[model samples]
Target: MTRRLLASYLSLVLLALLALELPLGYVYARGELNRFTGAVDRDAVMLAELAEEIIDAHSTDMLPGLAADYAHRSGGRVVIVDRKGAVLADSGASAARGRNLSQEPDIASALRDRSATGTRRDAGTGAEEYYATMPAWSGTSVHGALRLSHPLGPVQRRVHEVWLALAIGGACVLAAAALTALALTRWITRPVHALERAAAQLADGRLAPAPVIDDGPPELRRLAATFTRTATRLHHLLQTQRSFASEASHQLKTPLTALRLRLENFEPYLDPRAHDSLDEAIGEVERLDRMIHGLLALARLENSATTPEPVDLDAVVADRAATWAPFAAEQQVHIAVAGQPAGPAVAVPGAVEQIIDNLLANALRAAPPGTSITLARRRTEHAAELHVIDQGHGMSATERERAFDRFWRAPGTHSDGSGLGLPIVRRLARAGGGDVTLQEAPGGGIDAVVRLQPAAPAEDRFHAGRPRAVARFAAHPARAPRTAGATAGARVPGGSDVRT
Candidate 1:
């Protein structure tokens, strides 16, 4: 940016200099040529007067000496011609003094009672030379013509020097402008840079400041102050939200649990026919408790502004599958771990576990006795996927689509689910730069998939210590043949919240 700004400034300066200097140089060259021409014509006329007496008397014996003296003083070639255009004297070639040499245009014009002064290029040397011719008159009868010529090399040299001086001045001006533009660019962009850093830090939940000094532009300084205040307010709002969730989770859970217990205790006092009503009331309270818990989890997940980090997805899957295995077995269902190594993936520090637990809890609820819940780990083009497949009746496209909506549940779902689990899972997954999706599992079940950004692979040495990690869970050879298959979906209630 600084370079671009400086270049723009220098370009304008160069154009201005070119605009002024080019015409001044052309005009100076023309003026110099005119001055040289006029000087030569005057000198030629003065010599022509001196030669008038000598030529009229036909006493041209000392004419060559006079021409030579004037030529030496004026740095030019001189020639004296008689009335008939015959050369009488020559400063350049004394041997050609008697030559008939008036065929030249300037000499002819001079002999015709006219003066000539102009410049012409030398045919042999390609150098420019100026010529001035004057006619000498003895009472209106032309006595002779005096012609003087000089090379324009000296005037051209002066013009070149002037051009060089102008170019140097332009370059110096451009350099100074470049330096000034660079300083100004830095001064103007400093506040912008600070605000950019602060925005990034805020995105990462750091709440850094956008500090600007008074030396910067007024608009930028005000912007920096406004940005700092806005970021502080935003950080405070989010902090308050997370704090409320954390506080509410602890504060509300016990009351809800106690309320459910109190409702159960009223079972004895209620009539036999009212026992169903008492049970229904207790169930609703429990549902409310779970619902509130899930809502708080979602709140924390959303407001924490947690950044994704590298997680050994394979290890996380294996640990979660193992943790849920006993529960599956208690229901006479096997937990089947399958698929290739998913390697490390980018996810929130504890997001992978919460996502797995929520999906597994729902899967266990859906799976039938004697069936299996399959924990499958696989890699897609740019992400790792953990699909919790259960052998229960799968959801329709509509149910799957609406599953992630907060507090949404399938129409015929019979469980006492709070309908907040799928939303929580999705929120956590997205916060980890991933997603949770529900699709039809092979052979009839819901495939609850959690996809995450693939991260740098773990070291081989680390994997070497866990050679039995061929599936989502560490292999148990003694129980390798255990029965396992497809479980629950996106909108099912979770068993517990794992939110650390």
Candidate 2:
């Protein structure tokens, strides 16, 4: 954009400069030519007056000395002819001294009492000349005519000088205009480039503030200001969305918990066939509840800008492996971290931990009991990376592509697990300026790479991940604690807490 604007400005400057110089230069050249022609006419008039005086002094015969002097002073060819068209005095062209002048239009016109002046090419030299002829009269009776003509060489030379000057002046003006245009273009374009970079950051969810640019044209300044306002508004709206989702999720948990508890209490009273039917009903409710929980977590992660702090990546992997060990044992799978916790783990809080837990649970359900699930974390240049790899029947490319979509699961996979696990991991990673991706694991397993922002150098404090327990706490009416002692064997019918 900057380059294009600069080019346009330069083009306009060149055009404007040409418009100002072209006509003025031509006019200057024409004025010089006019002045040269005026000089020729004035000399002709002066010579005619001189001829009258010479005739009045009683000299009709040729006056060689006076004629020579007139020719020298006029810088022209002088010819004096009588009333009978007999040449009287010839200055330079003396061969036709007695030649009749009646044949010449200018001379004939002068004989009729009108002055004649014009310019034409001289046949002798092939050069343009200005000529003026006036009547030589004695007491109102025209005796002859005096003609004076001069070549226009001096006038042409003056016009040529003007032309040269105009050429040089135009060149200088255009050069100066180009330089000025470049300077102005930079002034206008620099700020716009800055704004473009800021807009990109905003698009990428960086939420960076727009830069303050107090320079450039008035209109550009206004545009910069408008961009800043738009970025601010978008940031605010995103925050509001996150807040709304969290609030709604918190509010819905209470009823879901109470309803599950009531359903579980009634399960023992039903017959075996009825019990089996009741289990299916409970499973569907559990799926719905898991989906809502996933949504709430996704919203929270998307709205957060919190950076990772110092925590042991290996420890995180190991701890998650240990916590999911029971589920792995149930599936007859070996869940392990590839390496010991070597350094301070990146502090990813509860959001990231839950994402990992969900991914592990899904892998355990899909893979055979003997499958091996490995979790590992390593430091990277920009962040700490976590991997959850499972040696199970891996999904196809299409399945992997849609794996992170909310409520999306493979057709053959267990219907009991909600499809929100991978998406929740992705949201958390993105919120921390990181990302999550699924790939074919080494030797035909599923590999999930999760990244989180690097911790600050000095910080060791890690914000605890959102607690699974607190997340389950109900604010809805149905989930309030019952007064009587609860049965030890009674379990929440749907362990999942879903918020729509």
Candidate 3:
């Protein structure tokens, strides 16, 4: 930006300089040449008067001799013509004396009248010359005319000098302009450089509280102050939101825990028919509990501190698979593992486990019994990939797109789920310098891949270990369902909120 501004400034300056210099130069040259020509003409007239005075006494053979002497002294050619316009004497060539005078109108006119003067060329060489014609009279009677001529070379020399000076001056002006432009560009770019660095630090989330200095131009300083205030406000707002979510989670968990315990105590007293009806109620409560747990997990993941240490992807998948083995076996589902030639790990611990758990749970619930679910880890030059594949019902393109959207359920499916599961998985994976995707599996199931930074020594376990259990179930029958028929308000049980 600074360079462009400077270039525009310099161009305008140069154009102004040229606009003033061109006409001024032309006028100066013209004035000088006119002054020089006037001087030459005056000198020629003075020499003619001197010749007339010197020859007046002798009056017979003296006119021709006087003209020759004038030419030799002035270093200019001289010619004498008779009153009839016939050439009487030439200073350099006496053989052309007494030539026709009618052809030279300027000379004939000068001899016929009193003093008459003009400039013209003789009928010989094309070289330019200045001429002055004067009558040579004896006792006020016109005898002949004297025409003096001189070359115009000196006038040409002065004009050439003027042109050279203007050219040199223009070059100096351009050089000065270039230097000024460079200095101005530096001045403007310095402050912008500082601002750019500050913005980069903010983007990296490493900026803490610091007062910004109001330095640089007025507008620039204002911009810097605005950025500082904006950052501060955003930081405060995020802190407030995190605190609110944590507080809300804590408040909601209390009654949920109490209700779960009461349900457990009531379950034993219920008959078979009541127990069967209560199971559905229990499932709904569990679903609501899972949603709350997901909200809390999302909050925790969002507030997690950055750790640069490399994490083992293979170990994370293997560990999660082992932990979920019993659950998968109860559902009669098989789990397997595969990967790239290079076994590498991602760069986050608990994040990888969370992502794996969400995918595995979704896959197990959707896949048919005895079907195999594959968990594979692979490493390329740039990234590491971990895949969780299951032979379950595959989703359409539209479903795949919104699969990770929070609280968005597929149409016509009755299984209880908190939509926050996939969204949390995706967020955690992305925060760990990785991404997650859902693709078509080999046997018409969903293939969920977790891609991350590939590097470092493979470990049998993650460094940062287990997370706290985030799920709970109802402990009593009446406390379990709380459906519209069961509760006083006729409200459904096991939703986001249970109204009294």
Which candidate would rank higher by TM-score, 1 or 3? 1
In the range 293-332, model 2's lDDT, one tens digit per residue, is 6666666555555554465455556566776676456547
Candidate 1, residues 1-500: lDDT per residue as tens digits? 65676677778878888899899988998998788888887888888998998877778988989989987887788889998899988887888877876898988988998988888886557888888889988787888898888899998899899889988987888788778888988888777777788888888778754565576799988888888789878878987887887688778877887888898888888899998788668657756776676666666666666656777878877877777777677678898889999888887666776677777777766778888999899998898999999998878998888878877777876566667777877877887788889999999889998888888655322333322322111000011111233221122222342111
TM-score of each: 0.74, 0.49, 0.56
Pairing residues by index, what is the TM-score of model 1? 0.74
Candidate 3 lDDT score relative to the true structure? 0.66
Candidate structures ordered by TM-score, highest first: 1, 3, 2
Better of 1 and 3 by lDDT: 1
Q: What lDDT score goes with residue 290 in model 3?
A: 62
**Global fold similarity of model 3 (TM-score):** 0.56
lDDT of 2 at 236: 88
RMSD of each: 6.7, 12.1, 10.4
How many clashes show up in model 2? 13
